[model samples]
Target: MSTRTYLPYIACAAALCVAQARADVKIGFSAPLSGPVAAVGQDQYDGFLLGLESVGGKLGGQVTTVLREDDQLKPELGNQITRKFIDRDKVDAMVGLGFSNVLMASLPRIAESGTVAIATNAGPSPLAGAGCLPNVFSTAWQNDGTAEAMGKYAQDTGFKRVYLMAPNYQAGKDYIAGFKRHYKGQVLDEVYTQVNQPDYAAEIAQLQAAGADAVFVFYPGGMGVNFVKQFSQAGLGKKLPLLSAFTVDGTTLPALRDAALGTISGAMWDVALTTPGNAEFVATFAKKFGRTPSHYAAVGYDAARLLDIAVRKVHGKTADKAAFAAAVKAAGTELKSVRGPFRFNTNNMPVQNYYAFQTVKDGEKFGVKLLGTPLSQHQDVYVAQCGAK
Candidate 1:
């Protein structure tokens, strides 16, 4: 053991430490990439990549790597994937969980690991209320927010009675609850169906028999495609005024074609939204993907942008949990949102405008056109329950 030998060892140790400090930022993304909702998840993933591309494949001046996992729309599977992302991949942050159940199941693990997760689509009510966590933030609206806008619109349009339908799940319950909160009209019937129920023939029959003035529903992904096509075939789309949230969007509208035309829905963003950020996002997404981006895609893009802003503020050192959280909170309302005027509520859920949109023919194809704002600068009711300012 010569002093020169010890000096060499010390120099090597210092170099290794420096290398660790400058490691590339890793992000783990989990979503239903191979299930009924696969299309939506793919759109979300694509939008996120576009966001990263906008920043030149880096976040906060640090090279970033994204590891994508398919949750298969299963809560248990999602939890497993999240654990793997934390324990095996050693990701610094996480994004994308398209369904409420998957997001809810993955939360505890994410919280325990001190990983910040930005939800792209699903926003369960419980998380927005008593279960809110500082590490979890949603780039999309709470499940009930858009539904409430549709409900309000239905009330304003003088719908005396309405038929409501949704999948039998946490998001479905929240959607109906939000609608009831704002809709003063009588609900003719409330129907809960299976999550991926392909044929809505039975439900459509019931809807036609109910003799309701309007129909409200919350079906996303492939279920929306099936339901809308069936509804159109059953002649219910023409007979009863159809109103929905998350049911008819860029993801499903193109598939529905003429079937979704004239269908009214409530959403936070559409391709037709008039804003510089939205215009650029729409044009760029169409050019890149050769199709319209969905609301889920918009949120995914915003989530990446938010992460970029926050990581830059913290200099990409997410190991300092408190500083990273502060950076995220500070960046929440500052990121350039495609949806426009985006901010997080006390619960880390979005507080933004909800617009009434109509599925209309756009150059022989179907797309959603913003009709009017049903709710302006809206914050969720669950914010007060979260105990955050």
Candidate 2:
């Protein structure tokens, strides 16, 4: 028991404490990585990784460890995974809940744990309104916001009779409702299909028989791919103009390819957008992933950037709850967003432009071309309902 031996033991203990203090930041990412909507989830996850890579795998001078979990696009599964993230993984923050249903199911747990959860997509109405939680923020537009833009465009273009179609779910309902809000036109029919329904033959037949001047739909992920492909196969793509939101984007465009040609959709961002940040993001993302990044990817990248700015502002001391939350809120509009100027509303959902885009052939590949801005500097209606500052 010499003084030299005791001194070495104390030095070792001090080193271990310092190393633990500098531990890597842990972030939990839960999404449907293996399902019909897997493509969308993968795009978001890829974008998240690309953002981290751009910063050399560190945020705010601290290395980050992302714990990814697949919710399989199921609400219950999402809840389970979120609990694991909060209790077992001890994640400081979370990102990437792909669907509204999954997000709704997981939000309570995330809020209860007092962990900040940034939505890369899935801006459900409930969360944007009365159920708004200070801990929840969305880098993406509210579900209804994009659809509302499409609806306004259709109305302005004089589509007197429009047929509406969407999946039978929370987001689907929100899309249709938002569309109807601004469309001030005759509605020939409204159809809601099973979320995972592969065959749209019956729906297409109904659409044709409805005698509508145009059709507005909201189908995401694989459902969008299937619906567009079948609609084209039915020879309806040329006959009837298709208007949609979240139906044709980077995730479904590549798969739909020629079939998606001429389909018009509304989104927060597109590859055709011109900005230094956007150009760099698109070039780097394509070079890294060997494909065009989707709107989903763009939002996911923004979410990562938002987190990085917040972490830096707080000096990586996320343990101080009040300071961390304030930093995150302040960083909302500070980053060089690829979507151009971006800011969060009172609801913590983005208040940005929703552009009209058409799927077209860009040289040898199919891509989105910016048509016009349907909703410029738009704020979600639910923002007024949300009491959060």
Candidate 3:
């Protein structure tokens, strides 16, 4: 009969966060660059930059210049870089987050400083659940959301046994958890490797020895390129079907070319999304950068759009964190998502469709193509868990 008895601490935390984000906003863009993950970082940056260009470099009535940093994919380095940005750059807000580990290390500082974070990428599940913070509003879905889509695909397609792999980290765990939620089949093996380790010979050997009907992985950035190359090298590509979330993207797909053939992936958006906004974005990105976009670009674009909406809501008043968060949340609460319809749950993550795509060769180029049905269909279970009513 008691409220505490019926609900968990995470629900309480979500409410507390929603209450605190009501004040001025300057926005900062932090991501990984000058390292193995640099490709993803750069794409994210380009997308945010494009958004700023659309609005003429001004957010609301305030002039905004992005302060970009290289996290180098190291936790310590990420913390230090974030500190320097907050202390020296005089930024009032943050956006275009690239990876989970980097975001994890810097989240406390963001929460402590009460600086609104536009969470463009890397939605680790804790932030969507127990660790949800009001100052942080995500433009991307959590890692699990996409992984869950692939898992359902596996289930629907009659894959009875699946082998899984991921670089050991918060995002990796979230990725596996997402897949398992929809896949009730036998797990032949679960392999966790060093984050961004360039070689997969040993793991590939083991996966080949396991003889799984299918394989699901969550490597992103450089790790994805290396894994795909090594998976092909180990000859597992001939032996197993591969399903992935964040394993192959626009940043890594060029490098993955032939190696990633036949691989399946899930996400909220891809460069091939047919929406007018997405088509415009892809056309602009390809002309500007001479390449197609990955989900990172779409997220970056969304983050910028998300920020623009928040600024427009209050006109010239950005010092209100709660107002900013509300505006961002409302901005996401519609059907104009890059992939299609997108909504927001109480946890500040997206309630959107999960798209299934496959890596294939088309004429002289290689890229992922849309393939199957949506798994979640504009829904995230977290809102029910949050008990917003």
Candidate 4:
């Protein structure tokens, strides 16, 4: 159930010392470097790489060369790609595996090789509990953590007869499970479909038939683009009112355009998260990327920042895998996350705010704007099973 690596523990400094002595500690980055989810993967890639650049290619006080590979969003491909990073590339650590399926496949590879795996994205559940490895750490929130915020919101707002839909897969199931944990409502229906099915006609037909008062969905990347477009075209946008996990934020919002208007989403930060850190990040990203930074980009940037801080903690010395892992964990605790304060749960997932957001037209551009305030703050109910103190 867990791809946890079992390496004998060592003194933090000792482990770091060994790693630092190595000429160049290699870090592996396995992600959807191509395919439909490339936008999401690219965002993650840019953030982590940016962090590497910012820190001068050193992590934990040791100089590093990032060995990048494309999983192409396939689990088997992910396994093969990870093998190359671990075996041929001789990487000492891994980071930025973008998708859940890819993360699941790569975990065992990391565990077996005694390499630290720092996830910039994709925090699947199994790794958080019984399967948790001391070697694997996430700079991103877990799979269901954000959806759990929506569940709590539904409970707070008193929305009964809500319909839920997601791509039929491990992550999709986890998202709905997290929502139902707090929702305590009449779930009109819980629907699932094949992952990345461009057309949601069949599901939309079923949704229209379900006649729920409100709907919650977890469709990211191209799937989000298609679902939102179909929802608007089918006239469900007005009648049912849509609420989302804010994963439908900056990345896919451009694709949805005006159709995303008026829909409610849940996230930790919007383009409007009025803070100095957020303002600088949003401004820089928009100017450089020529578009608003979606929550994905924001998280990507945050991941890079977190990595930089952690690398600095160990002085870029990744030779000591155990020390590097501890340094990363300590760094995570210290980050003044743009979403506000955050700390790692025992399961190594994030406990942070999840806000409700809306897509609004920003003149010639579109962005995810704040809506209804933050629903869940420093929240991740799955923590009960997370084995955190």
Candidate 5:
């Protein structure tokens, strides 16, 4: 009877010690999970969970807890969420920084606290250059990368005059500037519209009057759906060649459908890409979520995989912030990214390929078909300005 009682006590003590040894990995995920852009955030969140599941619901063999927040696509709200993640929850890492504007708003706090942040979308120029932070990394494209690819494609295709349009924001300006860097042609006009503006009759009229050879735009989410639908409604879809980056993607294609067909876009990844493991990722995501995964989802998935490699390398010792950051940076090289040709530059932005894809009818449904790569093994131009030695 004494031996039996003592044996139960010893077993209970061992279980408690094992539990203490495996600490929970806490992650705070913030995104615009409401309003018009909600689909973008939802895809990212779903993909992230899928990735975590692929690793057996643990990141680096540690049980992971994710705190989700919706910023509603507002910078002020994003900043508040960032603060809460850092101050109250004390998350080991943060992801899904939202769009470019929201990311910019939260940049200072992330920079100050030395938090390990992996951006699934919204990589602005400042983060890649003079204002670069050691703890920040983006599994998404730099703001200008896709635009630059479109610009080069226009230049190569002999589109002598191009009209440009985007929402009036930091990303919009960066895209236009990036296009201008490569096009070396006549710019009919650069139009900035209000965010979430539903009407585009005025812009369409301006484009028609300009008589440009092609038009390039950088609208994402609901804005893209509205713009492309209205542009097609204006009867400009056939008359003027439409080109874009993020304006016609999986997120917007379902809404735009036939109207988005024949439109060419610049992107880093798509459901149609044949990169190793991408087909399975696409299939699994579709089966799990009942929707086609966008490039945003791909990035979100990659972000999780990246953290898996990093956290495992450091054995989940994320308390040493600097060491964790270093591990993340090095993880970029080790990961066989679904996007292909991915490695972090000295600035922690991706050096990858950007391709031209055209929306097409895939059997009974709509999808994108790869046209040709516009840029390969490309690093953003701002890397030259980065202070990383």
Candidate 6:
């Protein structure tokens, strides 16, 4: 046993360390890029890239490679993409796991592999509660948070009766539950429509017949456009107070235009936010992308900035999954988000401010104006079930 015999072993260990240090940060981004919600995915993707560009085209001083995929808002496609990112590409992190259904389908694989996933949009309640995974985080608010804000507003504003409507899905159900959690008023009807349903004439008729004081609906992307347009065309815009969450936003506002005017929606972020760094962000995004930045885009931008902090905290060593996850969690508090009062709850969902925004004419175009803050520093009701302390 010569002492010199250990030289090869030491050299081999050193080589391995150098190799790990030089490894690039690989992120896989999947979202519904080609379907009705394409704008939602596109805005998020663009914002993420903008964030990366702001950080000198790197995450934690490591060269980064992002593999983008289109899930087309389909759970099956999302599952396939998640598997490919995990089993084949071996990405260090995943972002934009698609809509709620798609995200739910991909969660098991993500948790099983212990891969870090930062969801820019989807925040299903199951993931926020007993199904909470340390590897997964949502930069976006919980699916219920904004709805809760609207519910609280409706309740506080003394609305006696309201009609509720949403797409039939996990998020839609959660949204309705969230609304009921705060609004103790008479719910005239709980209308659940097919996801991406084109026509809402029947629902509007039923709502009109119900004679509710106000109407609350949860529709995003193209659905929002169609719903608002129809609601306006039906002359309900002048007859009934239309309140919503995600039904009128930057992603849908272009098509919505004057049709969405006077619509009050609950949200966590918008161009109307005067939070520090938001003005520059909005300006930069609009200049770069040629449109107003949506809450989805804000979340995506925040995700990249959060990762920048986390990856740097770990000194470009994202290979240590535990360390990387911890860093990301810690980065939640360290980063100044474009969305105000943002931090990760124990369940890895956002504890942030939710506000009421009214769609209005900004000069000649439609944009949201901050009406008031309904829920401040709100954490989801399901966080207690996460058992994360």
TM-score of each: 0.93, 0.93, 0.89, 0.88, 0.94, 0.93
lDDT tens readout by residue for model 5, 32-141: 88888888888888888778767755788777777889989899999999999999889899999899899999999999999999889877998888888889989998
lDDT of 6 by residue, 1-389 (tens): 00000011134533211222233788889888887889999999988887876776678877777779999999999999999999988989999999999999999899899889999988999999999999999998789999999999999999999999999999999899889899999998999999999999998888889989999999999999999999999999988999998889989988988888899999999989999999999999999888889999998999999999999999988888888999999999998998888889999999999999998885896777888999999999989999873
TM-score of 4: 0.88
Name every residue pair that clashes in candidate 6: none
User: How high is the CA lDDT of each candidate model?
Assistant: 0.84, 0.84, 0.75, 0.72, 0.87, 0.88
Model 2 CA RMSD to the hidden true structure, in angstroms: 7.0
lDDT per residue (tens digit) for residues 166-191 in model 3: 98999899889888998999988889
Cα distance off (Å), candidate 6, residue 171? 0.5
lDDT: the better of candidates 3 and 6: 6
Q: What is the lDDT of residue 184 in candidate 2?
A: 98
Deviation (Å) of 290 in candidate 2: 1.1
Pairwise lDDT winner, candidates 2 and 4: 2
User: lDDT tens digits, residues 109-226, model 1?
Assistant: 8888777888888889999998888888889889999999999999999999999999999999999999999999899989999988999998888888888999999999999999
lDDT of 5 at 166: 95
Candidate 3 Cα RMSD after full superposition onto the native fold (Å) = 10.3
TM-score-wise, the better of 2 and 5 is: 5
Model 4, which residues run further than 4 Å from truth?
A: 1-25, 56-63, 362-364, 372-379, 386-389
Candidate No. with top lDDT = 6
Per-residue alpha-carbon lDDT of candidate 2 for residues 1-389, written as tens digits (9 for 90 to 100): 00000011134533211222333577888888887889888889889877776665566767677778888889999899889878987877888975999999998888788888888878989998988888888898899988999999998899999999999989999999999988999998889999878999988998988899999999999999999999999999899999998889988887898888899999989899995689999998999889989988898888888888888998889887567766778898787788877887888888888889988886887887888998888987888788956
Q: Report per-prediction Cα RMSD to one decimal.
A: 7.5, 7.0, 10.3, 6.9, 6.7, 8.1
